[model samples]
Target: MTPHRLGIVGLGVISAAYLETLAACSTLVVTAIADLDPDRAAAVARTLPAAHPMTVAELLASDDVDTVLNLTTPAAHVEIALGAINRGKPVYGEKPLAVTLSEGRSILAAATQAGVRVGSAPDTVLGTGIQTARAAIDDGLIGRPVAASAVMVTAGHELWHPHPDFYYREGGGPLFDMGPYYITALVHLLGPIRSVTGASSRPQDHRVIRTGPRAGESIPVSVDTHVTGVLEHVNGALSTITMSFDSTATVASPIEVHGTEGTLVVGDPNTFDGPTSLRRVNDVGFHLLDPLAGYVDGARGIGLLDQIRAPRRGIARANGELALHVLDVMESLQRAASQGRRVETSTDADRPDPVPLTPRSEWLAVQH
Candidate 1:
């Protein structure tokens, strides 16, 4: 089988992880690379024998490209995705889908009309850490999930990120930036959210960059720094979520799902694999569970690989429908925070099928 061709539209910090993961993939090849910075694109392209540096438009129009990987920032997600769809190319993008719910809808709608697939990130949820927890819940180890808690706290990305300006912009708040991982994992472990009630605050209007060449430079913060919300899942399960950039630190499990029988502590959903621990209703303490599901030694590009392979089997686990729903949950939560009322979601998505334990070697060897 011929390898699927991919055109990457951005070369940001996160692009390295995807490139590293795709480098060893036999089923996918990066054919074209583009970025606002031509030198960056050229630098990245030179590393891949099959890839050529091109303008965004040129990459989108390239005959060598079979699909477009939208790695642009949150603000550019919709533009790049829609462009790909309009050109009849499938697109797999980084998370948040778009800056606004309506923009997100437009991308999906365009993809539908163009008859192309749309996939999105936060694929971290498809890893062993979250998948193992999902397997437990499905096996009744958690006997009907009742509630969940997701917590992510930090002083701010400005402390480490070289270009942290986007982390505090319109599409870049604690809730929007980091919420996708937690909320997507919640949907995977529990189910789709029905409604949400939230409260948020922006205690600081400016953040100082503590690292990189921009060290000590202050950037304006236009979005909330602390966000807390309650998500009501369709199954009547409630999930409490806190995403904060104002806090110093936290020792809490990234996520904890409670049920009548036990509580599952899920590891960080931001990575491909993290530890998952469980403690039954009457258990003495939480015990670590070995990796029982998801792509073994998984990495960033696996979701795009999963999407590529979906045509041969079931739906893509990290698909656009799920991403759109997650975006809805997030936008709704923001609305709830600003309105001081419960905001019912207008979208829904089925829980993607659980991934059975499979090694990277096995998955990479399969023909799509």
Candidate 2:
């Protein structure tokens, strides 16, 4: 099959992961790459065979490319996406959609007006860990889901990130920076939020960089160190999301869902797939549900993030597929505030083309 020509913007470390994952698939080909740092772009291009980096304009203008992957920094997502949308090209962005809610909305608005397709990150919801959990809920294995909550507490990105400048910028707060993964998973499993209310704080005065090229640099904190939001769902289910980077502590439960019959413990949404376990106390009392062994979409999403270094051949088409579903959730939320109406979605948004997530052949982190 002829592969979809893909052009990726931004050559950050995350792009390295995408390259690794893309090598495993064979649906899309990275025709070109673009980055503000010409040298950085050239560096990534050298790793790929015969594919060199180009300017954003050059990549977009190339006749060989069909899809534009906006892997730029969070703050520039809206501008890059709008540019691609104006050209009537499908866009797949990294995450947070944009630095601010207004920018995110404008990008969505432009895409809607142009009638172009747009996708965003945090594809881990489609991972077998999450999908397995979703399947159990659908089958009433967990009973009626009553409520959900997620806690993401980190010491801050400055400790490890080479360039930790963006995370502390205006749009670089705990909620917008690291929120997509946790929140996306909730929306995928629970449905869109109804009304949101919460408080945020910039709990830190300064940060010391511990890793990367710039070590021991003091970074200023501009946004909230932690953001606590309460999500009220249409199904009468309530969810609490607490994000913090000022504290170096782990959560008792990173993610948890409560229902009439049982509870589901989910894995970190940062990865593609994982072993998710469920525990339930039905009429027969409490028992741990078997570790779901199935092929899931998120594992495949690694390919999407890495399509440049190692190119994939064709597009994956599947209902409830990882990429498309996550994209819809993010896009819907981008415009959700303005709608003043309920936004509903399902796993059937896109046809799973790459391959349907199936039960894995062996058990690893997830077990019976």
| TM-scores of the candidates in the order shown | 0.98, 0.81
Model 2: per-residue lDDT, tens digit, 1-368? 56667788988878876676554445556789899999988888887664669999888777777778778888788888888888877677787666654565567677778865566776565566666666777778778999998889988888889888888886676766777788777766776555565666676778888997789889888766777766766577888888889788985677888889888877776664655667778444434455453344445344233232122333322111343344444334433433544355432232222223554331111210
Question: Candidate 2: minimum summed lDDT over ten consecutive residues — where?
Answer: 359-368
- Report, for all candidates in order, the number of backbone clashes: 0, 30
Scored by Cα lDDT, where does model 2 land?
Answer: 0.66
Off by over 4 Å in 2: 282-297, 300-356, 359-368
Candidate of highest lDDT: 1
Report lDDT (Cα) of residue 343, candidate 1. Answer: 96
